[model samples]
Target: MPCCKTCTTALYITAPARCSPNGMKYLLPVRLLLLTSCLYRRLTSASTMAAMWPKVILFRDSITQYSFKDGGWGAVLADKLQRRCDVLNRGISGYNTKFGSIILPKIITKETASNVAMVTIFFGANDASLPEINPQQHVPVIKYKHYLQSMIDYLKAIEINEERIILIGPPPVDEKAWEVECIKKGSTLNRKLAVTGEYSKACCEVADTNNINCIDLWTSMQKVQNWSEFLADGLHLSKKGAAFLEETLTPIVLKKLEYVGLQFPYWADIDRDDPAKTIEAYNPYCPSQ
Candidate 1:
């Protein structure tokens, strides 16, 4: 329903200790005074001006909120962001970019508050599903790009700056498992239309050309040995898988928001330049891995 308690506990346990005021152990009185002064300055800086805080809205589909066992990434991200800003989930199951483009305007109208800092567009998974099998069509790579670009244009048309939009590529589909599952479900057409990396690359190109942030969930998920463990089916993430995705994504999202002069709480502790300190999971679905 929210962030995984175990995951949060693990994050804190693995986090590097906060820098102390004293060179030895705890902060001395003099060090504490200096630290407080620094903190005050940081809090009052031009960049940290509270008025510019941005509201974040996530525009995704079924895969992002498949069920209680999956789609928890959005919830997890919302949990971390709720402390710093207004976070809303606008995920609609069985919708694609085409439908999203149609409904997003209505959502924008409802969440009429200005100063929208970020909108994470996580679609294309269902769009990649074939017609006659899934209600959504099998959008070819070229058409898919057009659909994505159209969505971007729609946002810009509605006054959402292109830089504030994020295009999240769909997570990798297990081709073998997908085919098997589709066949079992009597959906032969879908078995032939599962998405591939080339489709994802097209989406990335559109995002890059438009100067929007692109989160490559496809390639990122490929590195994990236990990819199936995260998926409810071949198409959706498992609860554990969603938590892992959230853990991997929050920092990147926060950094992007920060670059645009939006303020949000820092959830990840790893230094940007320090790769070794970064958390890399071999198998987040299983602790032993």
Candidate 2:
């Protein structure tokens, strides 16, 4: 029993940073200290770049919430950043700048916000709702601007500065299609493409004033001859629209991910015949550039 515990302790200290999906099935219960240590190390890394991987946060509304769905932009980003950075989705449905600004601090903290490569702020759809027609989500364009800036300030307080932020303006809406959707949900048409455009431009203004990155979805979509095809339910993005957004962001995201480092060595990079030697050779580095 003494020899067994000694062997287990040795394995625990020398455990590889990365583990298989089956978990420590190869390890007996007595040797589970390896698992606990691995988890604790991962948790600690969340606050600093000392972990196996860095993270990028997607902060947005419904558009971001549905980002991981099939053919969604989030999935595209994840694929592009495989083994480079972990993408943390912090999306909420039906939220605008007012509510988003209030919940900013709750979503992230200084401890968990460290080592974040970039954060994408995507909002304004609900805020663009017509005042008299859709009062529930209506936010004055001017107030919306302030709320966005406030959110940016909150991020900065968490150590995520403007240099690492990307503001995604509300995408162009299809008024005719969206009106039908509103009626089906027991409400009149409460949003307009033109008005939504104004909000998008306003978002750009904030990004410009702060000297951060901005993706003007509104104007960019309009440039496409059939901008309406980009929208699903007149508000969200269709698959093609998601693809467009993904393509637009791929290069930009890659550029920012240059700061992130790989969490662990790739399987192919490891020498299975000499596991101990492979672990010793591990180096923390990012291949994004």
Candidate 3:
């Protein structure tokens, strides 16, 4: 009779006749059915999101390779993106976009199997090193602009969608270091190389006009008081520096891929102002710090 009272209270919300001892057994089955339905919906939504995320490919130079004691930014980026989507690093040491244009297709063919969802192109440090192309040189700026335009055009022609391409401007070089090194080495032209700021701005302009995403790392690096934090040498990135870059750019990369209906894995928020604050100082190749 006590059991009947509790059952009657539960059944009052529904049908009292159904609260019979024999009928009470159906409650467990009903609860199980509801739980199964909820889980099924959750699984379906997760699968759909996973199918929507895009695969990314990165192209860069020595700064991305860590050939120097400080490793490249691309390596950090690859590690960050390792879980969410496929990140392929195709960076080579000492190569410019001219070489990039020649070899990118081959690399894509071999590495990506010709199926790239997005590509990030970073170059021009070496190209801007031309003797006659520096800001002070008499050479026309149009030539440099033309080279960039051609690279963009070639990417479009090779079946890479414009929407899927991002152009990252080079980071600032240490002008004083370059000047001192050039002087020590008696290389006048090195001192006369294109100003890092000017070259980066020019590249951004081209990317803007061509409807491609551009991140001006030159401007970003300028805000850091210690330039050495971003580049161990005047030209390449240190591990801490590369981590800063990856943190700043990863959000943008995820947004772009999302726009293309691609799902990306989790993104870690990195402080652009102090990426190296928590990281232990360690050489990329050497075990000794």
Candidate 4:
């Protein structure tokens, strides 16, 4: 059989299109056993099955939702992981910590939690909004941190563990530039740079308290001298900005994954002529007694 666009089809796997130097493009939710009918039948003798791919969940607001756009952070991770893991995104625009805490459990339940390799909690952009201007999205700085901690603990209850969780603070807002974008959208500026920093700081503090790794997007970007270039409309990440974030975050996630071996059997580990011959080799089921 011919190989996938990027990866060899030795193990009967499909290669994702839009392969970035950093992430995977057009990665759908696929189970390993369901990859092909031949392999599925060959593995039927095995009594247990593992998820085709482990998952790295991107849980956050709009910043995360747009991560798959234009070689963004999310897209880049998919590429880096190859078919080793699935980069699952659950981003909702205009959501703050207040609403996020309520919806967190619904998406990350015991079932989803079991196969997860890591989860990134990125929020606070909307929470950092000025209450007077963006009341619906505003979250008092103190409550914002509380909600973050609450989420960390919730994941722990399901055994996701502290080591697998990462917290990301809001990026620095460019007040003047964002104001111009707001006006173009027929609205006044609803956020301020200085005030947004508070929520970002709070996010870092929560990460500290929980002993979780944190990506301080606010401080890190501001150090760039011309940090405003990182934002597309003075708020959302532009292509350059997304690249910056992807570069900064890559090492952190990779380091955490050092302890986690790649998912499934590597191409070399598979039997080229009988792809399913080694299905039980890397299986999580039937661990040695």
Leading candidate by lDDT? 2
Q: Least lDDT summed over 10 consecutive residues: which range in candidate 1?
A: 280-289
TM-score of each: 0.64, 0.78, 0.60, 0.79
- Predictions in order: lDDT: 0.62, 0.77, 0.58, 0.76
| Residues 1-289, model 4: lDDT tens digits | 3222111232434454335744542333332322332243223333343443568899999999989986788999889976556888899888988898999999898656656778999999999888887899999998998899899989987757787899988998999999998899888999888898898889888988889999888999999889999998899998888888888888998876653445455668778888766655654221221
Clashes of each: 1, 2, 8, 7
Model 4 steric clash total = 7
Local distance difference test, candidate 1: 0.62
Residue 47 miss distance in model 1 (angstroms) = 23
Displacement of the residue 219 alpha carbon in candidate 1, Å: 1.6
Residue 204 displacement (Å), model 1: 0.4
Output the better candidate (2/3) by lDDT: 2
- When sorted by TM-score, best at the front, the candidate numbers are 4, 2, 1, 3
Using TM-score, give the best candidate's number. 4
Off by over 4 Å in 3: 1-55, 67-72, 109-114, 130-141, 179-194, 259-289
Query: What residue pairs are clashing in model 2?
Result: 52-263, 53-263
Model 3: per-residue Cα lDDT at residue 100 = 68
- Model 1 ranges off by over 4 Å: 1-54, 67-71, 110-113, 131-135, 179-184, 189-194, 259-289
Q: Residue-wise lDDT of candidate 1 within 1-289, one digit each (tens)?
A: 1122323432343333345444435434333333231133233433444443456888878865542333488777766665455667788987877778788878775224234657888877877776556755566667778878877887766446575688888877766667777788776637232355766788799988998878777787777888767666777777766877787778877765542321332336435685333333211112132
RMSD of each: 16.0, 12.4, 18.4, 12.9
